[model samples]
Target: MTTLHNAEAGDRDRKAFDDPAARGQLIRWFVSAAAISVPQAAGPVTFSLLALVLTGDTSGGAALILAMTVAQVLGAIPITRLGRNRSATWFLQGLIAIRTIALLLMAVLAAYGAPFLWLFLLTAVAGSVHGAAWGYLRSVLNGLTPASKMPRALGISATLNEVTFVLAPVAASGLGSLSPIFAVVAMAVLGAIPALLVPHVSVAPIEDTPHAGGSVLSPSILLWLMCSAAGGSAIAAIEIGAVALAIGFGYPPALAILFTVPLCLASVAGGIWVSVRNRAATRGMVVGLLCVMTGGAWLAAMQHSLALTIVGAVLIGAVLAPLATYYSLILDILAPPNKRPEVFALLRTANAIGIIFASAVLTATSLSVALLVVASTMLVVTLIVGAVSFKEKRRA
Candidate 1:
């Protein structure tokens, strides 16, 4: 590989700029990674509904998601343990194989018109295994974009998630209704295709250097991890609620798939707007998050206003696409390198927790009420962060 720059100005941030060729290379790789995630973000809808279809209305869709999350939380450390020594490629390839097999089984089960829950459980397992690919690919991307442009890169990347819903669900459910097996097979194929494009970079193997920092059980780390889990749970809550919103508003239950497709696309659109506008500073992001959560919650709370709900969904989604990525980058800027993955892992864990919390809230109250709480919490968090950021800025 060609050395782009070595000066502190260049190296302080770890990405390339000024080279169209490098940018092109980055685009292809990033797009390839993002492409695979399409199945990930969209797969749950199909899996959930598939469960409903194959098993009964009492499908394990929610349970499957919870199970997958449980697996994800448990899997993170071990994957990192293994990842720290192994090539990221090994994980990537393994996920593809695992998903391919699981999906194939799901297709077969559907073909046979097997028990709904059984096939869904199969799909859930496949989806869960594939989650590792996100962190691994993101690590690789950490080396791809310039420090200054990192936010934009991440923004665009998050935004592309919008594409996940575009065709997958419509195709899956629309066609899957007619032929479930074919839908499973197509998804399996799409999910596996990207592994081929990852370049063979000779990074130090996992065994070459031991993982940095403490064990996954370390105390300070655990606290941070819990917080991240909180956020993740919130995300899940919002996601489930969003689907509910789509259905409750008089659309066909199947329309959740259609609604999600555009939501994902819109997230990407929001990301692109941020990327081009260059407006994702710490304060801006916190503010944006607050705006989305609060606005969306208020809209949902109103319940009777379709216009308000749509506006809220759009506003809430606008911030989610790039929110996590930017937050991670900011943390990276603030923390030492050895602590990065642990931090990222913890944040992801927190997000899971947030989803759980959100789910609980939804169960206790209307989606609108739960959203009101979510929005308020988000707004408060953002305002506090913004205040701190301003203080820190002034101090500096």
Candidate 2:
């Protein structure tokens, strides 16, 4: 009787150790995150190519991105609110469906040679849900992973996202050579894979509760949002201006992938490093990384050589994952339990606003000028964050 009891106890322990649901949830979330990034990864290169093909100018590309960013900013809060009471899996499914339909419409219009204005309208419609979808994903992640394991999960997700960024452009450029419309349609289809996996993944519903200090206006949250905005602006400047930079350096437009691929690879490396190490970042570390990014942008802007551009890309990319991890960590630590999704939406809103600003500048001025603006924005934000960190330390 004692031997039989021991065997049963060991079996139960093994079962508990390898819970299928937990493992499945992690895999599904990673796939969903990668699927969501497909369009974003393709957008910069594909949209630029589309604009150049249709309007014979790059400004049209910038304008399209600007419209999308504006829509995302305007729609983030409301869309996120709608998901508050619903199942995250279902909400994400619906949003992804909407986005997929919008992309299909754009593809149809592009294939039929529709006017640029119509395409712009469709792009805005697609982007309207982008922030909400992102927020929902973040909330789902919180539900699926324990707080202690969140940093590693987020790091893995970030790495997968960077991998998408590395691969999508190559796919876009290659397919775009045949037809830009085909590339758009392809990305849309790929983006829907995550939605299909939603049914298999379980996400616990978040309960709403009132908290005295949960307001989004808290200084720490605000600071993080500002950092997100600055980071977004710098990244947008690099991505949107990549084609122009490549051409200016006497490289063919098709070779613009050279500008982004290495950057994304470096980001993947950073993310993997963070995941393996399993350490949290301090405000001081975040500020230091921001400084490195700022210096890189400045270096890239000051030099026109390919080598300088690659070096700058490495500098910026090395910090991307760490900065993202730190931002998510801060949000996790500071945001109220009931308000995580809304706060995440606000972060997305800030990023979209920054992208809009960068796109507008790119449209009005030169790529070099836009890069300098990015560098300046980073520097200013870094100083502010550093000051805040110092004050908090002194108080402690």
Candidate 3:
């Protein structure tokens, strides 16, 4: 571990490329990055589009999302366990190959109007594979990138995901008419490249045998995470409410789209911060982000006037970077380096599950009530976790 990489150290890190180890690691990272990019970019967007094409039903589209979330959670545990004991990277690559095959089938299904359930199930499987790949990439980053530069690496990874979101829509929506599966195939091809790069990452020679501890899930860590997640639920509720409030205020629902504009800008900017500045990844930032995210949501709710909500929306935009960065960093810090693939997948699952709960609330209750319920519950859990973590630290 070292201090922040200042100008000279960063220059050295840059020049470290001449060193064989650094050179090899960078090559591996970029190569895997290419493979991960297409799938990351196209999978969800295309899947939804494909589902709609197959059945012309929005519920089918919704099912694909729910399935992906559920499957990822279910898939992560076994994947992590396997990563710890096996050549998980190569194994993950194999999964990507399977995923590519699935996407192709989905293409066929979409073209011919196959059974809806089959199409949705395949979509879920693809999601599981994507989740597994994500976890693996994060773990690899933790191992290869020096502690001081990990934030930069994390920033690059998060930004890549953002790129995926932007491109998926364009490729699947616009160019999809020409070749629906082209986006998927491109994603699959790129997804597999990272697996090829995995063998290149030199596993540092630590002669010490690993401890096969009791339960891999630490009670304290789980407690903190669950608590954090609970409070964060409010952020989700508020988001839904914000959209409805805007619509009610007679500002077209599209006005809410402006919210993501700043959020996206802030996210990219935040990535640069983590990359260039030596910011210690801390739970404190996570708590702060959640609080701000919730506060923004609440503010938007209170601000029935479109103008006030817009300011709240900007605040919401600001919160995403810290929120995303914190969860990512926490996963990096807590999960063992090699076991990241599964954990990352699991993390996505948690997020998706959270979304599902939020969705349920939206469906069962009015949007405003849903937002209040999610936000209030989340705030309480966040405070409880903060208190517990403080006590634990003091005791330690």
Model 1, range 1-396, lDDT digits (tens) per residue? 235444554564444466676677577666666667555554655566666666675346566666666665666545545555566656666766776787788778777887766765775567555446555565555556655666677777666655664556666667667654566677787777657665444332121123434454454344334434433443554467766877778776656644344445557777787778654456555555655655665565566666666665566666665565556565454433444444555455566557667877888998767877776665555566567567767998
State in Å the error of residue 92, model 1: 2.7
* Candidate 1 ranges with C-alpha deviation above 4 Å: 1-21, 109-124, 202-239, 242-266, 278-280, 288-292, 334-342, 345-349, 387-395
List runs of model 2 lying over 4 Å from the truth.
1-18, 48-62, 112-116, 199-212, 243-258, 304-309
Model 3 spans with C-alpha error above 4 angstroms: 1-24, 27-45, 177-193, 196-199, 203-213, 227-246, 282-286, 330-333, 336-341
lDDT of 1 at 232: 48
- Which lDDT values do the candidates have, in the order given? 0.60, 0.80, 0.60
lDDT of 3 by residue, 262-373 (tens): 5456556655665565465566666676666666666665656666666655565565544556666665455555554555666655655666677788879987677666
Please estimate how well model 3 matches the true structure, expressed as its whole-model Cα lDDT.
0.60
Best by TM-score: 2
TM-score of each: 0.77, 0.86, 0.80
Q: Please report the candidate that would top lDDT against the real structure.
A: 2
Count clashes in each candidate, considering only residues at least 3 apart in sequence or on different chains: 33, 0, 11
